[model samples]
Target chain A: MVHLVIDGKGFQAEEGQNVLEVALENGIEIPHLCYHEQLSPYGGCRLCLVEITRGARTFLSTSCTYPCLEGLVVRTDTPDVLRARRLVLELLMPLAPEAPRLQALARQMGVTETRFASDEEVDDCIRCGLCIRACAELVGAEAITFSGRGERRKVEPPFGEEALNCIGCGACVFLCPTGCLHMEDQDGVRTLDKWKRTLSLKACASCGRRYLPFAQIEFARQKGEDPPAEGWFEFCPDCR
Target chain B: MGKQAIERIVEKYGSDHADVLEMLIDIQEKEHYLSRETLQYLSERLAVPLTRLYHMATFYEALSLKRRGRHQIHVCMGTACHVRGAARILEQLERCLSIKSGEVTPDLQFGLATVNCVGTCALGPVVSVDGEYHGHMSASKVERMLKRYSETEANGVAVCQK
Candidate 1:
């Protein structure tokens, strides 16, 4: 454990624990978008900017990526920190104006309007990369990716081709921060619109109702070496 | 032969994950571009995910996924080249090939693309074809330069037929 000072409050955090996690744990409440407990630190949002002081040198960094250390001093709401956070929010407003979380964060930060122009074609996506990270980290399926940069940026399959090795698990859809990705089931076919691919749903043997994509169950089976009995995965939880 | 060559590359690189980028560059050097099958093979041989290979393919400017044409045409769109009427030279090439930038001809004879800068700013209006730099390029010289390479190199196995 290491002792650190955040906003004049002293607290003990575990070794290598990031400042954002430490602050949130102690109720410091540093606003952030790209930081997720399950996924790795991306530091893409830039909203968790904080002023850190060590000995005599002082600098600003996104707290989510900055680890806590012994005798470290941090401030979450300094003038420079607020200035940088507000500008980042303002810049992001055009990208996801309709996202409720982003809008609420902007309002909380007193950012009512944006100085930059918005492109109507981008829809409501903040590009925090939660979906991509979740798919790659949790489900172990990288069905979609963030390609290009700036005006040419997009979240899609590489080379504009159909998703390769996608199991249609809907992990990306479930974890999307801005609700940009969509998944729907119809006539035993699972359609992940954002990924532009379709999957067949497995019907419960007893209930005759579709429960999950066949690929998801196949993916589960592939993870384990021992093969289960026949019809082992053919039933929903309720039927089982 | 192709699969063997890629396997040899992995063996040469010792399948180091950090050396994936270097391995990809070498494969691109041999295949001219990274094909899906080749990348998949590398992913398995290196014990890395295909997603990572695709990410690297997109991240680096040197690598390409599509099969490149026999003749490569890169027009420098840098500040120095732009000032020397590089746009006119690009326009001339596009007209000659009847294809837009970043596109290859149907016969796989030539590909037209642009670059930010080649660091040879002194050679303004520079255009490179198959790694041969042509400095001081002019719109009128586009046809003469293209005439140096004849057609019928590739069958365009994946050609579009109406």
Candidate 2:
């Protein structure tokens, strides 16, 4: 464990854990995007900027990628950090204007308007890359990816084509921060429109409730997952 | 990509995941762009996730996911160049080529792009074509420069005087 002071409050963090994880674990709020615990720390959003001090030297660093070190003094609520976070929020404001989470965060950060101009309407996909990371890290599908750069950057299947490697896990849907990845279940079919794939959901034998997507179950089975002794893919989580 | 090509890359890099970027660089240099097939091949051979590879590919300006042309034009848009009308030169190139900053010509002859800097601020508004630099570019010079490329392509001679 490494002892560090965040916002004048001393906390002990596990070795190799980042400052954002440490601060959030200790009930200290450091606003962030794209800092999922299951995925590797990608400091793309730059919202978790915090001031760190060690032996009279202080500088701003992204808390998500900055590892906790001994005798480090961290300040998440510094004016400079807040200012930087607000700037990032403003820069990202036009991209996901309709995202309620972004709106709430903007309100919390006291950012009313963005100085940047938007020539066209943009979707709620903030491009924080959570879904891409989740698909790669947790699900191991590596289905989605970001293509292009700068203003043309977007998350999509490779070359904007359909991804045959996708297993219909819905991990990306579950991990999306802005709720951009829409998953709809209708008539025993779950559709992930952006991925251009659909899957038939499995019904729970006990209650007839639609349970896991069949493709995800097949993926798990292919991974040599042990079936429950009571049944084989028949019961939902609740019924099981 | 063939399995043997991927195997060659893996063998050359000692199959270390840290060398994925270098391996990708080599592959892109040979293939011109990172095709999906190549990425998938590298993913299986290198044991690195495809999405991570894609992340790295998009993170670097040198790596391109789409097909490029035989000739690449990199326009410097650094502060010094920008003040000296780099945007105008880029706009002129886009108009002449009928392609955007990051797009390739339909004929696969030319690819236009902009860079932050090339550490040559002395030559503001600089453009590099096929690794050859042209300093102090103006919008009027774009047509003549492109014509030279077309002439070189047709005549089979390296006659780009600039």
Tens digits of per-residue lDDT for model 2, A1-240: 889999988898888999999988888898887898878999988889999998789999999999989999999887888998999999888777777888999999999999987547666777788988888778777788987677778888765666666878788888777888888888888888888877789999999988678777777767665543535678887887
Question: Candidate 2, residue B49: CA error in Å?
Answer: 3.2
Best by DockQ: 2
Write down the worst ten-residue block by lDDT for model 1 chain A.
A151-160
Q: Please give each candidate's TM-score.
A: 0.85, 0.80
Residue runs of model 2 more than 4 Å from their true location after superposition: A225-230, B1-10, B14-17, B75-116, B134-162
* Worst 10 contiguous positions by lDDT, candidate 2 chain A: A223-232
| Model 2 residue B96 lDDT score | 81
